[model samples]
Target: MKYPSLKNYINGQFVASNSARTIKVVSPVDGALLSEVTMSSAEDLNDAVEAARIAFHKWSKTPIKERVQVFFRYKFLLEKNLQELATICSEENGKTMSEAIAEIEKCIELTEFATSLPQIVTGEVLEVSKGIECRTEHVPLGVVASIVPFNFPSMVPNWTIPNAIALGNCMILKPSEKVPVSSGRIAELLKEAGLPDGVFNIVHGDIEIVEAICDHPGIEAVSFVGSTKVAKLVYQRATNNYKRCLALGGAKNHLMVMPDAIATMTAQNVVASMSGCAGQRCMAASAMVGVGPIDHIIDKICDEARKVVPGENLGAVINKESKDRIEKYITEAEQQGAKILVDGRGAKVDGKGGGTYVGPTVIDHVTPDMAVAKEEIFGPVISIMRTNTVDEALAIENANPYGNAASVFTQNGGVARYIIERASAGMIGVNVGVPVPREPFSFGGWNESRFGVGDITGKSSIEFWTKLKKSTIKWNPEAGVNWMS
Candidate 1:
């Protein structure tokens, strides 16, 4: 039970900030204070940014092969300390040990994919018209700020920081206030793995520090993951300052049960998607669009959902306010004529735990106007709607304002092909529940669920880290500015 008292990581060292204040990291399972992380204010943020700026010139000029070596070393260190780090994730984030481990594994996969970034951050050699050959090169954005969310502290940071760093850039991390300890451990591991100072810096604060990052002139770009409202604000503010931004916003994922889909398989996938992480995932299948076996599938999904008991250590919503809001949403939905079909609501949670627990509340007869269906509850509540035809299901999927990810379970290849083409979301799963963590593939949302042009974890991650300058090099071995003229 000996956990390190966390401090902000700056200039390759863990240091106490000017404020010297700490935010106690609490276990959502029992509300017990697990660890204390040093709280960084605007001053600390400025310090980290300044450090990254100072280190940027040297780090970005380093050889790509040498950079790859550091990433390899970091990967090794993570493997060595996987259990300890994952424990911190589970303790603070309240995910099950298994889920936490999987989260770490996914991050490891991303790191492995990013290992080739040194080489894969490649340039293109092109043959244009006549003897004039054109070439394009990829270069790093100077100082980037990555704002990570609480749900996947370690995993998302892998998405945010690795590609940026691999491309010879200095990255400043604004990890979730709820789980900064996990990120502190990551910073510690990266240092052990031999990254240079200022190349990786951690600044901790709520929204104030994040806003400062969005507007910081010294910062060249920003990457973010959070709610849609915040994502839009961050993207707008950053782009307004002429900065590169990759903002992943909120999601209202849909799971469609096509008639051709096997009933039992659909039920299993739905349960895994909705119940896993206690439905706290942004990509969790919150809305079920019923088709093929519309009525029959809802019954199966509801039955499987009923068995998902609210238990201690299963994890709670982030905090008390989150818990209250989720519960209120369920009640309001019920009042709005959505039937509270089955109760997964855990009883009075022990205050020793975060007391932010909401049991799985399943609602049927849900309408578009109902709170449960309309709002992204960010809890273990599932809403079921029946659509008779495939077109109707696809229509329901598209009608949602937030379009992060969507899935259709079907055996018919034609139907699968049609829905995937028609469904308007970033990630789609034909028979899969959650189609996240597919490394080397771009993951993003359309509509309100995402902002900015670059997606993370796929082809877009590479695009996000590097900038392309279309060099129309009209070569006469002569003038440079004259080419533009």
Candidate 2:
């Protein structure tokens, strides 16, 4: 059984890990090991970094139009193998085939959006300051390390690496050790698309390798997407190493319903927003807040949530530990005053709960200080918190530690506008369920929820990849090439 002998894609080749130590890729649906991947260590990360450092010169100097052509081909290759990509994601990541396909669609959009780099990378020329015509041009910041999360194996890579590569920066990616195969496969496809050697490298492993990648002086920038604590660590280390970083942290997204907001629709949106991706998404709805019909809204939400029966081809948590942690949170909540409205884990499951199956568990009368509300469960669980007025709801939301993505389910445009205006979250969705930022827009969290300055994709990505250098071109015919002053 050949399982794509996973290895670090360095210098345009698949380099084997130094040790035979491997991480087994498992299917959360049944807790089956889909494949075994040899883990890369700190030495392997150094090798990949060295390879990227060597490849950056030619890759960066490569013509922008030529680079764009590569992306066009890459898009075609991705579409041609969309099903294969989907299968890989489904097998290892536990996302249903449909969800996996959707993830690919997001990657497709990112690459398509990225091909427009020629237009986006356009600089401006201002003719106002004396006889000087100041012009700006974006230049790649050498080698960059893009660390992606597990839940979003392919989509996240697109968010970080594409922008880095499109803007001429060579990207050395360290995918999650859990689902490293999909990312490694993507690198192969990128190679087939004719991206130069070392233009985009792939390495997979644990903190040993990740720390090395973070501490590497040669890595000019680091873009990380993971938990808040890890993001803080990466940011602190990367900055101390004098490298730039954009580390997005865990989120406790709130979906508040105003008293005037629609009830049935809001409930359904909350269900999908919180349960989609098995609540593994960074912006997954964890806390539900609103002023109107708190009791009725809770009932409506529970009704809709019950619709998400386990083994209905939704998705599973990343691993058993994650699933267990989610259960622990629920169990502790039970010990607390909160009551479980729908025990997705215990109610009914197609497979065993021992396997990564946590359907959509809903809790009611959850307080702000509760562990369920305070923690980032990263699973299909919702803690319904009530407020007396819209003011109280907003205040509750504002008090939370995380402010990643929040949405409002109100037909009332005034209230929606006010929420959008006043909410301190990074991404806001009105009627939309998931507030993941598209390719053209920046995606990030706020406060302790996000670290450093840029986003995974969108405009901030472009900025993250390049260093803006202002050239003060003073050509008065007075400053001749040979004449000083």
* TM-score, cand. 1: 0.93
lDDT (Cα, tens digit) per residue for candidate 1, span 192-233: 888888999998877778888988888988989999889999
Model 1 regions more than 4 Å off: 1-5, 20-22, 127-132, 348-355, 469-485
Cα RMSDs, all models: 3.0, 2.4
Per-candidate Cα lDDT values, in order, are 0.80, 0.83
- Among all windows of 10 consecutive residues in model 2, the one with the lowest summed lDDT is 476-485
Q: Candidate 2 at residue 467, lDDT?
A: 82
TM-score of each: 0.93, 0.95
Candidate number with greatest lDDT: 2
Deviation from truth (RMSD, Å), model 2 = 2.4
User: Could you tell me the C-alpha RMSD of candidate 1 in Å?
Assistant: 3.0
For candidate 1, the per-residue lDDT at 380 reads 81
